[model samples]
Target chain A: MEIKHEKIKTNLQKILPAKASGDKWDLHLYIAGQNPKAVTAFNNLKLICEEHLKGKYHIEVIDLLKNPQIAHDDHILAVPTLVRKLPLPERNIIGDLSNKERVLAGLGLVDHSELKLV
Target chain B: MKKKERPSHRNILPKSPTSIQGLDEITGGGLPKGRPTLICGGAGCGKTLFAMEFLVRGATLYNEPGVFISFEETEKELTANVASLGFDLDNLVEHKKIWLEHIHVERGEIEQSGEYDLEGLFIRIHLAIESVGAKRVVLDTIESLFAVLPNQLILRTELRRLFQWLKRKGVTTIVTAERGEGAFTRQGLEEYVSDCVILLDHRVNDQSSIRRLRIVKYRGSTHGTNEYPFLIDEDGFSVLPVTSLGLNYSSSHERISTGIPRLDTMLSGKGYFRSSTMLVSGTAGTGKTSIASQFAEAACKRGERVLFFTFEESPSQLMRNMLSIGIDLQPWVKKGLLQFHATRPTLYGLENHLTTSIKLINKFEPNIVIVDTINGFMVGENQTEVKTMLLRLVDFLKMKQLTAFFTSLTSETENLSIPDVDISSLIDTWLLVRDLEIGGERNRGLYVLKSRGMAHSNQIREFRLTNHGIELLDVYVGSEGVLTGSARLSQETKDDAEQLLRQQEIGTKQFGLERKRDAMEAQIVVLRSEFQAEEAEALKVITIEKARNERFTQDKIKMGKSRRGDVSIKTTGTKKKKYI
Candidate 1:
């Protein structure tokens, strides 16, 4: 019975790598409508994730004009807000994610010193 | 057919009266309903307090539930700060009458990454309003959003949208902002929220702080344009609408005694009119306070409430001083018929003093209000401001049909001239108390300079502060003008002596004339008797001489007749004897 239980636990761990590694970043970007700033923010965020987060992050685009009721869940004040969820403590970044280094540092994916040379 | 366009009076908007003292009168009714009213002021100028009071008063007095969204102060701090003003925000929240939301925005914690709208704030406010079914809303210092939010354009847009949303919600709103340099509000919030804009100012003039409120703009409404002074006491905000008080106070035909019999006699023998304002102006040591105390005592004696505001003396000191003169205000105070509010003139600005006294007048509902030494209010204010404030106060008192007595201290040489504040014209009755320094003695003299609609004595009365209150004596008007004090006493004594001396002289002259008349009568009686004796002697002599002559003449005639008439006499004698 113990051996069977251990085998099931290892299989479950292998099946859920996103949870086992604890390195997955779930980001939700809030926007009023399909504006240029939202588009730029989406493109910039996609680039940052590809460079740093790679496959360890999932991006959810939420248009506030369509789903404005959910904006308060993450305390979104300004449009195109970047909320990093699924981490122990949630953090928010306002404006379009133009500064890749500052965005990386804010998401806790990179240290300030690591981005100093870049 | 040409039709004249008549001015339509059908589109008048309803207002929400805040029930604040003197505020409704200036706003015509109150703030505009279902619209945003911006209350902007400098730091510590009572912006938050004003908004909170509006909401609280609206909720309590008008039965309108409210929502308070504070961006700077927390619910606990806000509640505690307004607790001193007797507003129980917690209890209101518990009863679901008010909803208080504290939105803390830390500048360090927020970062600008992308464009966003303030939907979160809107959602929170909506939820608060809906939860409490609020009809009134207050955003205390919404300028804090500018400190935390980096995008000004987005913030401005969201703010404009929020104001419109509030209007759509049909809730009267008060949005507080910080005052900017040379602008009504910081960030020029007045440009967008133009429905109603009120500016509050906290300024220190002559080391005393005064808070003033002025409606910069009120659309579709006529409001007082002058800056009104407002006071924040335990009760709440009381705005004194100085210029808004029209000269339409109702006049009363009733009369009230001035407590001094002689003074009352001087004032038409019926004292002042019931709602008349009396100004007792005097120099130093002219018994102004004494007169005010007497009036207060008289009001209390008549079972009317009296509020005595003394700026130069404390309550205990005044009581003790009045006690020495047998006024005995302690009984009236204990009976709750009399109240004394004593403070230093330097403690507050002139407007503050005015508002405070007005507040007390409203609370106590005094039939008579006596402000001892209105000159004390001139310590930290200009003469014009003082006079304006006094005019407003007198107007309010008269409107309420309350007898108001004001005492003023003039300069020694100024006499009846109210140098500190020229409120004589506003006064219905003006009694000028002066110090008559004559014959090396100082005495108080009181005379009515002007009394409207009543025949008052113009003669100066010597005012004496005896051990039993004030006594007004008729001053002696002799050759040296109106004589009072020792001069009057000496003049009266001299007049009495002169009168006595003249009476004595007249009495002696009458006595001498009577004695002379008696002697003349005696002389006439003696001369009459002597003349009678002489006439008797002459009569006796003439009778004896006439008898002798007649006898001689008779003898000669008888002898001649005997010779010629022997025969005729014999015949006549014989015939007479025969006829007999």
Candidate 2:
């Protein structure tokens, strides 16, 4: 089983480079201070990215209070703003990321109808 | 008496005067000091302008620095908008007298995910206030938050707390909000700021849009409740409160000329009282403008500035017409002593006209002001509004001790009644110029209808527009009533002819009496001569008869003496002598 998993990972890496140069999922979570909403959004994004993207995804956490000027770069107006920067079309989902279906759909990671079956 | 006995509540509340034209008087002073005043209005109703003006005026006029926090518009947009009004907001900001902040809250860009308050906004305001040491703070349209934030509960609590914080900050603040459908303000901002709420409405009446302002609520204060009409022009906002000025203007005993000598004589030989309002009401072609121009010319000739507001004629047209009448107003215009402001009554709303007139009056500072045909102002306004505006204007003029003349065009059909505006009571002197159609000719007749504190003429004089200006001639009053125009000349000629005929008859009667006295004197002289001749003839005849009787008497005496000698003895000689 291990030899087969290793062979599948090598095949995935070989095909992923042909599709895109960077990681499949590049997410940026914007938070101001240690807000509970920001913390919850960070944990939810981590869990979803690990389950769906595994090693193909990357996450960047931005503390607005520490680096407030960076918030203007992505036009972050509210705390706990999640920006999807990797795909050809960038998207933004702002909230505590409590709704799994909506977060997954907003991130374009999973189809909306498929979440009901899960 | 009752008013005096009542306690004056106006003195109890310490007020910060806004210094805005007509607003201070309407608000009884201004917005309550150090309290938030919510100003709500629809789009383009002058909410932002009013707020900015308040801040600008407060900073400039009252020497108080202000902070402006704009939620909808950028600082550059605000600066450009108010720059037209001659308010150099950028200069003021650079001078540290005013601080402007643009709090941009885009609805789609900002998302409230978790529990949050408007601490960011509060801190920014605090920094701005501290930077300028502001006494007045303005939050323009706080309702923009309702669009940006999804959590209304947090917003409401935060807004309430913000107001309380502003109150505790001890700064006189103004919060502007957008008017909502069937609500005084959108997002129910009126509930949060309970100190004062002023609502501005832009309504279209008779195809003309007029902005009106009303104080919906003022806590712990008595304010004007009437809906005041305000105007937004090059010079910010000016609210005209109708009849807000009571009868408290100081009266002047000095007299000013009406520009016509005969007309002056008609007004008790002195003219209208100084600082008094004079209404000249006349029908069409009754020389109302002529008289108004004459008064303006007279004021200008006195080296006093004159402001002529003409609604019917242009400045050049008026100047040319007056020149034709020998008034020579062009000189005054060239000398800068007379100013002619000609505009159509429909150019703006009634309130706009009032504000424009007031601004012009202030800028020009004329000693005498003449509004040619005030009836022109009645074209787009109701009767009550016209009367109120006139009253307010007249009161303002009287307060400033400026002589004012208002001309009104009365319809020919309504000759018996006064002008349509019914400003007779507000005017101190009312001159009625009417068209007197008599003997197949129409002539202008002028009479003083009323003079409040002077004994004016009761006789109607013929109003004539002559080459040397207005000339008032006495109308011929005979058994056929008043006769004017050619009829007066004919009547005068007939009277002169009859007087001459009567004088000729008296001369003939005196000549006949003189001739009869001369003939009687001559007859008396002839009678005296004839009597004297008769007396002479009688004397001669008596002497001759006496001589003849003496001769016969001598013979008879001789005979009687002989007989007497003979009879002497016989007794009858005495009888013979007696018979002789």
Candidate 3:
């Protein structure tokens, strides 16, 4: 069961788009400075959010250097913080965005089998 | 089109016989007859049982021959599965009352274009129905046709035509459909069963698997709308309806012993009435079986037959284990006062178990019946089936005026692992057992959850397994709370802590009150002393003023005396002249 579930998750990641269009939950990836790992993480998170959440998600790229005051107001203590400000139940995920399962759970749309771990 | 018969009018539709236990009551007798009723669910949701029970019950109980066409399971597997429920499918088959057929629809069976339509299925059904003169039929997973026929449009049209043809044939039918991920039926077969639709769902909630049945739609009949919980046991399927019975139910005013003397004393004088269903539920090893056995033994001793059903343990094992506590069931078994029927829960489908149980219940006519470890019976069955089975058992016991007792095992970790049969709502008496951990020890505890029409022990009693039988110890209401599994000798520690806290609160309040009273007392004393000094000073000042006035008067007299000698000589001449 575990191996099959993992394979489903991997397959899902392959066909997902980097950025979803016309999603209701618009999330901006805010980073202080851009590095190669940071760029890869942002692309990976975008791909996952697009595939699973599909039309219900939106990804935006934000450079904290240009808007330092906005980052401070939003309480962005970490460099890479994904902020969901549009939805009624506002939330934030702070990480390099590698763990797809955790991100899915944080978004409150994780599958029942996958949500158990979270 | 020609003048329709008033009795056969759609408005006066005949009731569909659910054949499963309490379902008939909820359905107001049963599903509509001569209509294609749909039963749909996901994999392992007990859709097959729902369909099979309807057909088998139609043949045996209702005296209506039936046909079963399975698209998934084989004839042997279906027979063997329901055998444990005491369905005796072999016997039913031998009697020619029921006809069973398994249809295979592999990927290779598909044909691009064919005029055959669903005629292949129609022929098989017709043959089976004609062979047994069946008035009812079941097609287990007609959706297998979808897998065999690639063209969805042709499949849909043929299915609609097939239902019309069956309706004309006037044989009541149940067509099973595989449920999709979130939808009610996998292929939305709900749209196809045009006349009636029922949904069967199986799920494991809180670690206990439950089966639920919902009447999606029942045309032209007064039916129950609630999602009734059901049980799939050896006998057959049972639907537990939450609705109330009619006002004309039997109400005999007689009480019987619960087999526990102390407990009986707490319940008014004796215990529940003769035919009352009693529920004994508790955490594992809370002595549920022991309590149930005691009830059985008591009835047997009174020369009444007792039927003991054990899903968790065998008859010999249960007898041997109970004997350790001095309950000799073997003597009664030999004398026909006691009968034991033990089997694994998976021995048959839920409906078969129910039917088998019904058969045993009828044949034995036991004064008392006990089902040990109801949780095991919940494995393949869903919640609806379990509830229905219990309801039927309770109703049957009440109808026969026989006492029935059941024990359910609750999960230790979860408060409600599975909706451990809510016998609480149906039974006349409910006994709750638990394992309490206090003072680092475990103790067995018993409490009455509820007892209808009788006063029961509300306090939790600590009990033990002694040489003779289970003994109810003194009510454990010491410094430490009631002990459940084992009692630790640390009551003094808890008592000391409670005493200290009580004393601290009392001391705080006493000190506050005494400080305020002492301040008031000191103020009163100071005011009294100051008033006394002022009074003495006022008296001294009055005395001094009086003395000064006397001295002043005396001085005035002396001054007048000194001046009077000179003035008297002058005034004497005037005074003498005035006197003359």
> What's the distance in Å from true for residue B436, model 2?
2.1
Which ten-residue region of model 2 chain B has the weakest summed lDDT? B109-118
Q: Each prediction's Cα RMSD?
A: 10.4, 12.2, 32.0
- Tell me how far the alpha carbon of residue B313 in candidate 3 is from the true structure, in angstroms, after superposition: 10
TM-score-superior candidate, 2 or 3: 2
lDDT of 3 by residue, B504-564 (tens): 9999999999999999999999999999999999999999999997797667557868888
Winner of 2 and 3 under DockQ: 2
Candidate 1 residue runs with Cα over 4 Å from true position: A1-18, A26-55, A58-74, A95-105, A110-118, B1-10, B111-114, B419-421, B501-580
Residue lDDT tens for model 1, B1-580: 2234344444565788878777888889999999999999999998888888888888888889999998888889999999999999999999988988887677766666556677667776877888889999999888888988887998999899999999999999999999998888778888778899988999877777778989888999888988988888888888888756687777999999999999889988999998888888888778888889998999889999999998899998989998888899999999999999999887777877877787788889999989888877777437678778778888888788888898887786655555434676788898988888788889988899899999999798999988999999999997788898888989999999999999999999999999999999999999999999999999999999989977875675588686886554444447558668
For all the models shown, what interface RMSD does each have?
3.1, 4.4, 30.2
True contacts kept of each: 0.47, 0.11, 0.00
- Model 1 chain B worst lDDT run, 10 consecutive residues: B1-10
TM-score list, all predictions: 0.79, 0.77, 0.49
lDDT of 3 by residue, A65-105 (tens): 55554443453433455666556455555555666665666
